[model samples]
Target: MQTLSTDVAIIGAGTAGLAAYRAAREHTDKVLLIEGGPHGTTCARVGCMPSKLLIAAAEHAHHASHNGVFGVDYAAPKIDGKKVMQRVQKERDRFVGFVLKSVDSFPAQHKISGYATFVNQQQLQVEQADGTQLTINAHRIVIATGSSPFVPEFLKSAGDRLLINDDLFELTDLPQSVAVFGPGVIGLELGQALSRLGVKVVMFGASGSLGPLQDEKIRDYAHAQFNQEFYLDSAAKVEHISHQGNSVQVRYQHRDKGLISESFDYLLAATGRRANLTQLRIENADLTLDDLGVPVHDRYTGQCGQSPIFIAGDVSNAIPLLHEAADEGKIAGDNAGRSLKNAADVRAGLRRTPIGVVFTEPQIATVGLSLPQLKQRGEHCYAIGEVSFEDQGRSRVMHKNIGLLRVYGEQGTGLLLGAEMFGPAAEHIAHQLAWVIQMRMTVPQILDLPFYHPVIEEGVRTALRDLNHQLHIGPEMVEKCLDCGPGA
Candidate 1:
């Protein structure tokens, strides 16, 4: 066994791990990055980049096929599944190659290609591929082991027929038909993409809401839009699933649709994700495991137990978006480095404005606190402002007017709290709202900002204006310039 020592040891080389490593490197040169799996981060290799590539191809086909509404005539768009997957893989490889290039820059000894297990609080035992062993002792450690797609045992029985986001993009060709087992972000995005790509997609979910939106209005709108695209049993309770030769069968009970039995060419499980901690041997550390079998850590600082270990990224199981993962990694890495000096002022707080999006057409996006979250926190006196894109000028012109945007604000104060939207340019709108919520800006303040006319953003302005009216703050208070004359 070889022995090594480092100032900081970072487990996992995915998004969160890479961010932690970079942040830790700023304070110490003696940092070791350990990867027990592939070098490419999840976003580059599978999660975001590759999935968006598939969505882009699907969007092209969808737009061409549905151009009649725009008075644009074209031949029926036929997609080649093999070529589509090839393009996605080619671009995905490029992204993965970029991450690998960064990994190659570190000293060969600084990176370990092995499975890491905790021997104790400060010591780790790593087993290499060729059966060699290495022991690493570090003053501080950051665990960013990421996560894995949680497929049900019944679904996994189908073997090669089971497709998770991890393997969805790796396919040589798209399956002729698919039964999507969940209608969360992964399920909805992939299911819609596949449907647009000319695959028969049937989606099943326990709730009518799409993703994690807490607003019933937006959820119902999303359900309607998505239901129009494919066969979705939103109120489904899946009882059994099994493999049938090359295909898979699903048995479910639907609220209004009654018992339904269906089979498809493949089964894609978007049930959810579980933290990758089976081999972490966290019991050797002083950290306390949560109900989900993940180490309990401070959300703001990522400190685990009373030790110098921190947990971040998908492993923390807070917010699973790539951007949030990076934020968590930075916090963990920064705190891990500062722990050497016992610095009390070195820790940073986690992001308060939560921004999440599903990249389906007429994208679904939410920012900051949702209606349910606010209600759960005992906030009940908020005002709601909403706009339907169905009548919005820009959406009407673009023929993309099939969703709604709702903003929540303090009833009397007009302070913007959160927003949920299902509309065109929802990604941009959600991002802007996130910034507004982060800055604690009110609806009137947001309205004071410039909004170009006849654009998707006008929808936001309309919502804010409606909120301003409901708040009934005097014009002088809302318009800060009201007290000023022409040349005050």
Candidate 2:
């Protein structure tokens, strides 16, 4: 057996895995990245990147279908699904190739096709694709294998038509009709996209809410606008098939409303995803797994207690979102490598705050403790303010005025704890809010910052004004402004 040793070993080369790999390499020379399967199956290569491309194409088609709204009239836009798929696949291929090339810079070794199983506490028996087994011993190991789409027990995985995010793109032809079993971000975005692509889409959710992080107002607006049929409060009992050449059947109940049946061209199990750690044999490394088989790690350090092992990305069971995975992986990689540099006193980075974004048109983004979450925690914070995109000149000029920005401030302290924004450029705005929360800036600090006109940033100025008004600081500031100038 070929034996190897490294300062840190990272399994999974996806977002978090790559981040960890890069960070570890920056700190030390001996870093190894081991990955299973073909590299294209990663989220960036397959899930998020490809899906977003298709979603963007669908969104463009949707906009073109409404040309009259923009003073241009047209018949419906024809969706050439094949053309869209071709472009998406091309993009996915280019991205994966680019990422692989970039990772070559780090002082790290890559094992493209290997199944790593723990042979002992500090050694992992690596089985290559061609049946060659090797052993790699590492002082610290990071599990960033990420996650796979979840298949609910109620939904049988027998048929080929049923798809997850990974398999959704493999279809030779577009599904005429689909039943998406979850109304979270994935299902909502894909359902809307498929609907625009001439696919009749229905979404099923246990609760009435669509996206857990989505504001009710925004979700309601989307559900009302889209042609998607939502089966809220409905639980699927068992989705099965009698035989081939037949539609997939779903048996569900509307809580107190009893039973019902529905059929569709395909069923998408967008319920959620769980970590792909089954192959790793976590027990062999003295690491613990949660009910879903995700690794248990300290939130601050990304370190698995009782084991010199850590995990980031989907394996950590944090938000499972892309950005969250990236940041956690950054910390995991840094900590793993830094541990060697300052083995006696190294402390990993802590995630005191998290930002979330759901990429829906009029997309929504949030950071820190939300109002309800704060309320639930008995946090008395009363600095509440909201700004309408309609009031912003930039949004008006861009014809993207359908949005709202809400800020929750600490009652006595002017520090911002939470911010939620929905509308055009919400993703960009969310990052700015994340900085605001991270710094815990006061309202005065925000108002003092100069922002240019005819830009979405002006929205932050408006939000600050509203916050000052809510705090009755605007009147006081205006009175002080006259005499508080440089001359005064």
Report lDDT (Cα) of residue 473, candidate 1: 62
Model 2 Cα RMSD, Å? 4.9
Q: Each model's TM-score, in the order given? A: 0.94, 0.85
lDDT of 2 at 142: 84
Instruction: Give all candidates' CA lDDT scores.
Output: 0.84, 0.72
> Clash totals for all models, in order?
0, 0
The TM-score obtained by model 1 is 0.94
Worst 10 residues of 1 by lDDT: 479-488
Instruction: Name the best candidate (by lDDT).
Output: 1
Count of clashing pairs, candidate 2: 0
For model 2, the superposed segments whose C-alpha errors exceed 4 Å read 103-112, 212-246, 251-262, 288-293, 350-353, 390-399, 451-463, 475-488
